[model samples]
Target: MQIQVKDISKIYGTGENRVVALNSAAMTIHEGDFISIMGPSGSGKSTLLHIISGLDAPTSGQVLYGDTDIHKGNDKELSAFRRQKMGFIFQQFNLLPVLSARENILMPLLLDKRQPDETYLREMTGFLGIDTRLTHLPHELSGGQQQRVAIARALIAKPAIIFATSQRAILTAKAAAKW
Candidate 1:
């Protein structure tokens, strides 16, 4: 499996205030596989994504990518892993207001101190139908357009897994369909 999550559990708060988010959830995902997680509100769907992407650590259990334990890695290692091995799409469209679409797409490469691959980047923008809007800011685009830009940014990183969440659920469904 490309991704293996074993016996994972997450709890928020402590004592009387503690809330159990995930309880011993396990899953295995292979490369090129498309999976969708759906459930009622507060069902740990988003929490599962966070654990799989190494964005949040489980209170117990293991998240393995290949043979390495993701949570066992150091912070720098985990950050690098996230940058290179995971893509994230949030419903809010977390684009920098100051950066253009192109710049926003290039943010990951720039963070890694690597130059953006112009050909691939252009291809991705074209694929997402945002090539003409490369110079436009997020505010200038519609919600759907902004979401497309977010998708492009996520794809540019070439991640192993993409985690997304939507409170309204419709956006998540739409985004998943678009993807």
Candidate 2:
């Protein structure tokens, strides 16, 4: 899906504590583009990602996925749209401690009442070197292992667009390259 981010701005707090994370940011992401947003700490890269991906609302302006203004959707509609069209790899590995790696990786599909394709699942887990860790819970895995599980979960549904924050932050250089 092609994404169009209009003149969006995000502001936090009020009075003396007001912080402007993004101001009049605009960009167009065509389909199949491997765009990366790079900036130092306190910059608005994460904020932009969140807004563009419908994870957060822009204080003003619009984010459109194709012709639809994603920010206009209600909670359920947005959630469904995201599940169907997008994959997200968060900077923080947001894994459920009680769920096994397999469960976490399959969560998206399960949420949509769909089943996993065993062949694809095997191929993906094998490729990521996490096949042996599928039964392990998040607490039982190493940091890198957990990150790999997050990556696998993002890719399992074969989403059209993958929004990642610090995709390589935890993996070894070689491991990051494969992803």
| Best-matching candidate per lDDT | 2
What TM-score does prediction 1 earn? 0.88
Q: Using alpha carbons, what is the TM-score of model 2? A: 0.85
**Cα-based lDDT at residue 85, candidate 1:** 78
Please give, for residues 75-178, the per-residue lDDT of candidate 1 as tens digits.
99999888887888887889999999988887877889977878998888888899999999999998999999999888887887787665666867879999
Highest TM-score scorer: 1
Q: Over the stretch 1-179, how does candidate 2's per-residue lDDT look in tens digits?
A: 67899999999999999999999999999977999898776899889988988989999999988899999979999998898789989878899888999999999999999989999999999999999999999999999999999999999999889988774445557776897
Error of 1 at 125 (Å): 1.0
Provide the global lDDT of candidate 2 against the true structure.
0.91
Clash pairs for candidate 2: none
